[model samples]
Target chain A: MKKILLSFFVALAGFAAHAQETTLAPDQNPRYAESRDRYIKAQDQLLVNMNTTVQQTYKAYDWYEAKQERKLQRYNDRRERRLLRAQYGNFYSPYDNNYYSPYRYAPGFRRNGWRRGW
Target chain B: MKSIFLYATAAILLVTTACSRKVTRIDPVDTPDISGKWNNTDSRLTAEELTSQILTEKWIGDYVQAKGKKPVVIVGMVTNKSHEHIEAETFMKDLERSFITSSKIGLVQSGKKREELRAEKADQQTNASVSTMKKFGLENGADFILQGSINSIVDAYKRKKTVTYQVNLELTNIETNEVVWIGEKKIAKNVKN
Candidate 1:
């Protein structure tokens, strides 16, 4: 009876060793397969989110810059015209020939040295 | 026999536990919400566009005040101090466009424009009769020079980040060195994982 019990024990040990040596396929291992799938899905979602954020951020910056550009352009245009008029006198009306022509000033104004008086 | 059974049970439990801990595939339900966070909050403009806008606002106002007189304007070099590579030329162009569109200030091009003008005048003098081509000097200098800088800061963590940008512009009297006007724009962005 003792010998029979020993033989049974050896058999059990051999069976356990054999089972340990066996390798289960990934698909067969439900826990491993599920966890790996979850990780992959998470990675894909993360990528999509990252890409969307980048595009949106770029667009936002672009819009803001464009608006500001328009504003600055308007300001500069007005400023330039003002400066031009100041330098050359208003171009809207014909130049006063008398005011501009050195030879057409008040009669005898240049001859009598009376330019300073005016 | 009892010991063998215990050893077998322990081995199976260990294998199951190890297998259960692995991540193989992701669930569709847990997919990230990319659309929710995706949005264009800030817009960008080319340098020329920006310059035009600035010029239009200040130039028109100044022109109206001067009563159709072209006021002298000196556009100074814009400085870029931001984290990204930015050209101040865009801002300058916006200022120039504003001046040109409004017909308010006499906007002078920088050294480059002046050189080009000089070369053209020289060519006219040599290739064409002096009498036919009018020789004119840039009579108006900038009465006011506009200058400014851009700056920014970024704060970030794992899969999340924040950025802040600032633009500061100033108009100053060239002769007196007095600041007449100051314009500024600030932008901020937040990103999540």
Candidate 2:
């Protein structure tokens, strides 16, 4: 009985050694698998941080750009109108009621004399 | 009297047409900067110089040799903190274009565009045929991200002002957070009013 029990224990040890020689399931190596998972989680978090940073930076940038665009448009339009008025005297149109031009049809109004007034 | 009327008509016609807003097309290269603020030439030339500098750095070679592939890059935000309204997007696009044309690095979309791409993919998942639908989590992640700022300093006295714009860009490794390359381009203009 003792010899049979000893042989049975030896056989169990051999099976355990064989199992070790064979590839273990991922779950069997909890330490390595957990470390790997942690690494991946850290990496994913890093990437998420990176994306968030980029998005926030661009959000501010885009807001400023649009604001600047509107401001520039306003400035440019005003400047262009001022330039047009300077280059050519106030535009007069007969059909438009909203046309409030400084130069109305004066029978004797001289174009060159307007400069002399200044 | 007939000749006087004809001359009057001719003079009126000439006056009506000659002094109105006249637009003459000229080469953009020939277009001089009327306002000494940041302009297209500054953006284009800065991108060209920085792209060349970024590519020639040791980090690119190290990454290529270690990874056995070209580094994928995504251009992030370039904040414009200049005295004038500088469109940093144009400069960013110029940099992206130069990177692509160089064929030395891979480029990926960032910010809203990337979100748009992901949204499209999500839509495709439900709407498209099973065989034709794109898979999720298949994006080639960027290995490096380039971000920067455009800053300026202005010194003015009475009618004369000197504006100096400094464009500083840095490329950082996305994985390691290592700044691989840093570049700066300075453009200055003197304006007199």
Query: Candidate 1 A-chain TM?
Result: 0.27
Candidate 1 lDDT over A1-118, as tens digits, reads: 9999999999999999987655566556536657667979895443332101121122324334456678999999989977865544455546633355333336555675323223
lDDT per residue for candidate 1 within B32-142, as digits (tens), equals 545222112222333433454455566447545765565667565555565565555544555566667766567765554655676887788778885776476745666
Location of the lowest summed lDDT over 10 successive residues in candidate 2 chain B: B76-85
Clashing pairs in 2: none
Interface RMSD of structure candidate 2 (Å): 9.2
Per-structure clash totals for the candidates: 101, 0
In CAPRI terms, where does candidate 2 land?
A: incorrect
Q: In model 2, how large is the Cα lDDT of residue B157?
A: 60
Model 1 iRMS (Å) reads 16.1
Worst 10 contiguous positions by lDDT, candidate 1 chain A? A49-58
Which residue runs does candidate 2 get wrong by more than 4 Å? A1-118, B1-12
